[model samples]
Structure formats: C-alpha cells, structure tokens
Target chain A: MENASVPSVDNIRFDGSARTRWRLGFDRVIGWLLPLLFLVAILPILSLVYYVSARALPTLSWTVLTSTSPYRTDALGVPIIGTFEVMLLATLLAVLFGLFGGIATAEFLSDRVAGWVRMSANLLVGTPSIIIGYFGYFTFVLYFGWGLSYIAGVFTLSFFMTPYVFRTADLAFTSVPRHIREAALGSGAKPSQYILKVGTPIAFPQILTGVFLAMAIGVGETAPIVLTTQPGVLVPQTVYSPVTFLTQLIWENFAQSQSSGLQVLAFQAAFLIMVVVIALNIVVRLISSRYRKRLEGLYA
Target chain B: MRWLRWVAALPALAPAAILIGILVALVGATSFTNFGWGFFGFHWDPPTDQWGIMVFLIGSFLTAVPALVFSMLIGIGIAVASATYLPGYLTRILDPFVDLLAGIPSVVYGIWAFVIVAPVFGSVLEPWLVMHVAFIPGFGPPTRTDGLGVLISIFILTLMALPITTLLIRDALRSVPRDLWESGLALGATRWEVVRRVAIPYGRRGIFSAAFLGFGRAFGETVAVAMVLGAATNLPKNVYDTGNTVAAQMFELLDSAIGGTGSPQILAALAEMALVLLGISLVVNVLGRRLIASLYTEQVQGL
Candidate 1:
C-alpha cells in the first residue's frame, strides 16, 4: 500500500538533494486539499446566511416588525415576542442559579460534591437538547399539568442553560486568586459578602459572556419549545398561555409549498433568527477572547 | 447570609437533580412496556399498534453514520487548515463563521433544506446523480416526499456536525507542541509530512473525541432531521427514500400518542424510545468527556 503511493524513507537519500514525483505529488495534494476542503466545508453555512438574507429582503418591513400579519401563519410579531420572553426569563433564572451554583461548587462545596456537580453538569450539557425538551414535557407538561406554558419552557430552557452558566462561572470563580478571598475573610467580611464583594465582581465579565452565550443558545432553541410550549396561532396572553417562536414558525411554516406568503414569512424569520444568533455568538467570542487574554496577562 | 450561602447552590443543584429525575422518569415510564427481541424488529405500524423501534434506529444511524464520516473528513480538513495552513487573519475570520454555523438553530437548517435544497436537488442535482450513478445504492430514483429524504437529512446533518467537529479538532491540533512540528520539519520533512507524522499522532485522542461529539450531535438532532427526513415510519429502501429518526418520530408521534389515540401503550413505547436516545447520548457524551480529559492530562504531562 505504501509502495503504491510513495517510497519508504530508506529508499530516499538522507540528504535533501532528491525529490521524487510521488513525494512532490503527495506534498502538493495535502498542501492544496486541506484548505480547499475547509472552503467547501463552510460553503453551506455561508450560503445559508446569503440565501436567507436575500430571500428575506422582499418580506422584511417596518410593518412585519411591529405587528402580526393578517394571515394567522405569516405573523412574525408574536413569535418574536415569545422568543424574547422565553429567552429573557430563562437567562435570568440561569444566571441567578448558575452564579451561586458555580460559586458554591468552586468555593464552598467539598471535593466530592464539586466533582459530582461537575460530572452532572457535563452529563446534562452532553444530553441532547431534544431530550431536555422531552424531559420537560414529562415533568412540567405531564406531571405538573402546566400543559405547554411559558413557565414550562422557561424552566426547561433554564435547565439546559444552567449547566453552561455553571461551567463558565466555575472557571471564572476558580481563577480568582486565593489570597483575595483570604484577605476579604481576614478583613472580617462574611463568606457571602466576600464572594459577592470580591469574587463575583472579578468574575462578572466572564460570567456575563456565559450569560450572553446561554441567551443565544436558548433564543435559537426549538426542541424544548416544541415539546413544552403550546404551538398557537395567537401571541401568548400570559406566561401560562401557549406561545409561538420564530423557530417554530420557520419549521412549521417554511415547508408550506402551497403559500408563498408563509414561505416568505418563514424566510424573514430565519433571517432575523440568524442575525440574532450570530450577533450573540460574536459577542460571546469577543468577550471571552478578551477575558482570556486579560487573565493571561494578569497571570503572566 | 447563611441561608443565602446554601441558596446559591440551588440553581446548579436543581438542574442536576432534574436531569437525574428525567432519566429515572424515562425508565419508570417505560418499565411496564414489554421490550422483547421482537420489539427491536423492523415492524413499526402504529395503526395496528405494532411498533418496533428498529426502523427509526436504522434511520437515525443510516443518516448519522455516513454524515459523521462526511463531517469528519471536512472537519479534519478545516481543523488542519485552521491550525497550520491558513493565514492567521483568514483563520480569525473563518473561526467565528464556523461558530456562527454552530450557533444557528437546526430549524433554520430545516427550512433551508426544504425550501432551497429540495427544489435544487429535484430539478438539478438529483437528476444528474440518477443519470450518472444510478447503479449506486444511495443514488437511486428520488421518491415523492417533496424531495425531502434521507440524503437531504444526511446533508443537513453533515453541515450541523462540521462546525462542532472542526472546532474540537482545531483545538486538539492547536494544543500540539510547536517543537514537535519544528523537529519534524527540521528533519527535512515537508509541512504535510510533519503534520501527518507529528501533530496528528499527538492529537489523535482529541480527534477521536471530536468525532464522537459530532456523532452525538448528529444522532440526537431533531428539528432539522424532522423537517428534512420526510417522517415516514418505514425502513428506507435507499438514501433517497423517506425515513424518520428516533427524535423525529418521537416528536411526531408524541402528540398523537398522548392526545389523539390516548393509549398508554404507545406512550410507554415513546418513553422507551426516549430512553434509548437518552442512553446512547449519555454513553457517547461520557466517552467524549473522558477522551477530552485524557488529552488534557497528556498535554499537562508534556506528552
């Protein structure tokens, strides 16, 4: 097999004087192929961005942004509101829980407990988002009788979001110098006060990045919403009423080959979602990269 | 203040507890269902109440396995290029775009597949494929499922897996010591030769973990697969045939199972399906984590 492609090392001169056709071919193939493949790999994503934006140009308007369409299916207003409501609620819960949960794991929990928390978080994060939705369906929808309500979606999204926040916060809190905590304690600050006054402020930037990342993830998530939120034509009356999402509109409406109008709405929704999701991710990468560099500078 | 100290742990603890409870509930819900070898048989007709998970299992793997292979090839290429071949400025721009791909929801991918890809395939690509490679198994005649089939599902999944696998593998490649490559190149080896001989061998574990992670994502993905896969409950005859994955089938079947038919048996069966998905994902995720941890340990030890 090796002989078919190229010569063995022993066959070649030890000096760099000789270069065979096979060797040159192998070098050129790899030299060109990897970069070309990388370009091909990103084509779909680039095309998605291009396609949605171009298609959305006709349907996007001030009217579309402000109010629901007269057709029940083509409306963007309610789904957009539902999307923000669920994301904001979930983010708030996730941040609150994640901050303390992370603090506890990094600062207060015993090694065994910390290990357990880390393991669980890892497992939960690894679990498919759909399963998380199914889990929400089982607990909140079935057991609690919430049916497809905002609270259920919020809880489920928060459940999914918490692990990410926890991991980021844990990393952030752990990076706080041990001496700072000691100094705070020695200054007669209580543990809570020390954590709040010293550790949290130090970790806030990184934690905020995590929160934003989670928000992006939750905002775009469709599975949990599919299972837990009531898929309705109307905007949600309250947190308890069933809500529509932009993703749901895209999924349910885009496949409608019958109506060009619904398809256009779906395309516009997709474009909007792409914008928001990409924006959040860029924010995350920017903040996190700068935060990492700052930490490196501090350590250095 | 003391109460607050303990309360801070609740948010983290609650999710962990919920995850565990979900697992237990899945088992408990499905415990009453009979899962003999026959249950794994490929007879999934819900009307007669004879539901076996084999078809969906095959569908999921049939799409996911090939998609994983495709993604690995592209992902490895991207990873290699990003770490070694690409200019730093290009890599900087490309990295965020790849992340943006990952961040985009699957539902959008589904819409893209249905709206843009399906028509394109039907009008142009599928006809060409059929003419050129009709003998091949996956390149057969396209069925009448609005052009949504396993092939499209595989394509969408490949796109979904690419960014995840690329990012993981790029990190793995980046972590390889510069000295290893320098030493190999110092021995009069070409850049490709140095990368193949030094960086890849050192980062093999991370690469494997990346593949596993991609596999995990592909296998359990829902919305995109649901929209593109045609949601048929039968075994696919070829890649062009309509098929349904476990998650897709569950999503479609759950409502009917819950409200329309309102049968406990079907609900239990759906629960069993969820259990299987849960189990496979958990195992794959744990393995991926282990591989990552091992690679980290190796790097720390200066290996």
Candidate 2:
C-alpha cells in the first residue's frame, strides 16, 4: 500500500554497505503480504462462481432453459436465442464496419487525425454503458422512431463494441509491414484486392481478437441493448419488436423481488451469463495468446 | 487502392458523427434548462422539476475516489509483487484471474452486490458504522430502509476496478529494468528496498495514471453502483446513506422519459445530467491519457 516509500539519502548511505537484518525481515514479510493481496484480489471470482452455482444449481435444469419461470414457460429459450441473435448481428456489424474503421485509422487518416480518432474511440470505450444506451434511446428510439426494437439493439451494441474492435484492428493493420503493402501494390492488384488479400490476411488474427473481445463485451451487456430492445418474454419476430436477453433477465430479477420461481430463474440466468461470458473471455484469451505467440515467432 | 482507404475512413468517421449527434442532442436538451446553472446545484428535487445534480456528482465522487484508493492499495501490491517480490511462476498463475476479472460484465458485479453483499452491509455494517463511526461525516444509517448505501457501492466498485488497475500498474512496474533491482540489492539493500527504491519510483507515473483510469471506470460504472446506491431520491447526509449517481439517474429517468408518463422537462433534465457525466468522463480519461503519454517527448529529443 505504501508504494512510494522513498529511501532517504541518509538511509541509503548507511545501508549502502550493510546487510541489515531487519531489512531482510521486512523483505520476508512483504513477500508474504503481496501474494496475500493477490489472493484477496482473486477471491471474488472464486466466491462469485461458487455462490451463483450453489444457489441456482437445484433450480437450474434443462427444463429451466426451456421456460423462464413458473408462469412464463419456454423460459430460457427466448433470451438464449435473442442474445445470440442480437450479438451475432451486432458483432457482424461491428466487425465488418470496424474493419473499415480500422483501415481509416491505420491507412487513411493523417497521423494527427488518426490519433485524435483513436483517442475519441478510447473515450467512448470508457463512456458508461448506460450513457451509450441512453444515447441509443434518444437517437434511435426517439429520434429515428425505431421504438424499442431488434435493429436498435444491434446498432447500440455494435457501436458500443466498435471502438474496441476498430482499435485493435487498426493497430494490427498499421503494424503490417510497409514493404508488404508496397509489394502488394506493385503486383498490379487493385487497391481493394490488395487490402482484402494482403492486409486482411496478415492482420486477421488481431482483427479476430478484436471481434471476439467485442463479442465478449456484447454478450454480458445489458444497458444499451435493453434500452434499445426492451425486454420481452418472447423472441422478436420483427426487427421492431422487444426481445429478451440473459443480462436483462438477471437485472430485472435482482432489481426487485419476484416469485421464488422467478428468484430461482434469476440465479439460473446469472449462472448462465457468467458461463457464456467467461467462455467468451477464455476464447479471447486463447486467440490473444496465439497472437502473442505469433508475434514472438516473428521477432524470434 | 487510394479510394479503398477512403472507404475504410468512412466507417472510422462514423464515431465522429455519433459524438456530434450526442453533443447536439445534449446541447439542445440542456439549452432549455429551467434552473440555468443551478441545475448543477446540490439540491436534487427531480419531482419538483429541479434537476440539481450536485448530490449525484458527490455520490459518484465518493464511490469512485475511495474505490480508486482501495484498488491502488491492492494494485501497487500486485504490481510490485510481480516486478520484484513474487516468483514469475506464482504471478503467472494470477494472470488469467486478472484477465478474466477485466472481462467480467458490470451486471455480474451488480447482482452479487445486490443479492449477497447489500444485505450484509445493510444489516451488519451500516448500523455498526452509524454507531461507532458516527463521528465521521458520511457515516450514518442508510437513508433508505433497504440497507444499500454509498459504503457498499465503494466496496463493490473497489472490487470491480481492482483487475484493470492492477493490470495497468503491473504493466508499468514490469517495465522497470531488472538491472536496477539487482543493483540495489548489490548495494546491500534488501529486496524490499530494491522494490521501494527502484521499481515503484520508476513506474510511478504509470501507476498514477492507472489509478486515475480506474477512477474513471468507477465513475462511469452504472449498474453495480446503482444496485447498491440504495435511495435514488435522497440527498445522502452520511456515508452509509442512500444516494444516486449521474449514470444511475440517467438509467432511472429512461423509462419515465420514454413511456410518455413523465414530462419532457424530465428528459431535458436527464440530458443535462448526461452532459455533465460525459464531460467529467472525457476530462478524467483525457487527463489520464496525457499523464500516461508523458509531456517530455520534445524535451527528450533535444527540442
């Protein structure tokens, strides 16, 4: 905790040639203390997983996924389908558009403009999810007359995720060797072909990493999607209809008291979200690790 | 080929439009504010059409700043531990935990805080703090009966911000040259001295910026803090009192503003709050980035 314990000149001068016993003792204590802090930092993940599982396991059956609660049958299917549908559509929008955004940042803009754009995107990344959701609500729901609907949700989540996606992809493209870009251009290929065949293939892993990262964020995201696509018990049959999502289910259940069946349903939903989110995160971890290894190989 | 880059630029330019759209909407909404600059005043009576956001801003400050301090305490430990104290293998095991923690959604934290942590804080800690620490200005009973309070929000925010701050600080500490550490020890300084005298100072700028970014994260955090903030209506008088944040108020205002139940004034007021929150987030994050980027580049190149 006391990170800035600057050793004064006097202490350093005296300890310069002396192997002080207490100094070693203090070192031993810190060696124990730090890892303990690490443990404390790691404790929440362990307890959260344990707590949700223990609470929801009994009520969490295959049938639970088929129905939302005691009254709402076909319970989990709606959200599962809705979540995947929204995320797939959103991630697709973000990744495809994000690739174009990456090109702009990496290849198109002047250095100053690119830096500003990247920084703005970074600012947007940290902008509260709720704010983005409200923005979606104001712009699309109110301004565009989209209502609380599927396409609104997709756009909201994609915009929310786009900054991260484009950022990584942008960095990846910028790092693509200049020589390779020139070689592709010199080969008499059209610019589109050169970019698609040459730049895309090289930065594919990092781009994929960004896509997965965005998906991981999109999966557990509730606010923006919820604001745009207000939760319903059923999957939307139209682009302009309310649809359910796992995070919304959890948020609603915990926000207010519900029936015990609904309570159990909340935990089930939480447990499932945790699983999918962590799974997505692990996939990201795998992809990033592979990307790291590849980079290391290039350097090696 | 030249035009292809422009094609990519089109989508990249999209965010600018989004930002402008948001700004225009907020600017238009806020231009018609009923109370002028008094909208940011301390008293928050939304029902009375007084959308003073001083309390929500205070609520955000109280939760995030303390969480930053708490996360820094843990973060400095982990960063220094990995850099100079802990063995590589041990820190390696903790890496995935931090990574996964960084990826966790806010709602997961929100639910846990709501379901499990809030009750304990409400029943146990709130009364104890009110009784024993009543001398402290913020330490009072929960303003709402449900037991959620600023203290629980701080606790949860600390937990939520831990991983990112730790990772950020860890990156900085890891950048410290190993030679400096060994040289310190060669001078008969203990490992503790090597860390205290060498690694930390070297990465202090990064560590500071990291902590600042963590504060930004906590400030912008909506769901988790809202879940534990207790009473959205009350202007909290004590640490354990119920409160609201700008982001939380924004969320709460959404339904009423959209459902045609609330007047346009409410939406307008909420827009002002969003503008305030957005401004704060930008300043904090931009300042933090500037700190991390360092202003010494020109000087370094002998400019």
lDDT of 2 by residue, B1-303 (tens): 666556657877755666666778677765576777787687777666666788788778878899999999988887777666655666667767866777777888887777777777777777777778777666644444556778888888888788768877776776676667657866767777777878788888878778777888899888777677864666777776778888877776675565666577777777778888888888887876666653211111100
What would the per-residue lDDT of candidate 1 be over residues B194-243, giving only the tens digit for each residue? 67888888988889988887899899998889888988878888767889
Give Cα distance to truth, residue A138, candidate 1, Å.
Answer: 1.6
> In candidate 2, what are the lDDT values of residues A101-190, reduced to their tens digit?
877778778888877777777677767788788788777887899998988988888888887787777878887888888888898977
Estimated TM-score per prediction?
A: 0.90, 0.90
Each model's lDDT comes to 0.77, 0.74
The digit string of per-residue lDDT tens for model 1 on A186-233 reads 999987788789888889887887788777777778888777876665
- Which CAPRI level is candidate 2? acceptable
The two-chain DockQ for each candidate, comma-separated, is 0.40, 0.43
Q: Which residue ranges in model 1 land beyond 4 Å of their true spot?
A: A1-21, A68-73, A177-190, A254-257, B1-12, B142-146, B255-259, B294-303
Which residue pairs clash in candidate 2? A66-A74, A66-A75, A67-A74, A67-A75, A68-A75, A191-B1, B138-B238, B138-B239
* Poorest stretch of ten by lDDT in candidate 2 chain B: B294-303
Candidate with top lDDT is 1
Clashes of 1: 0
Angstrom error of the Cα, residue A170, model 1: value is 1.3
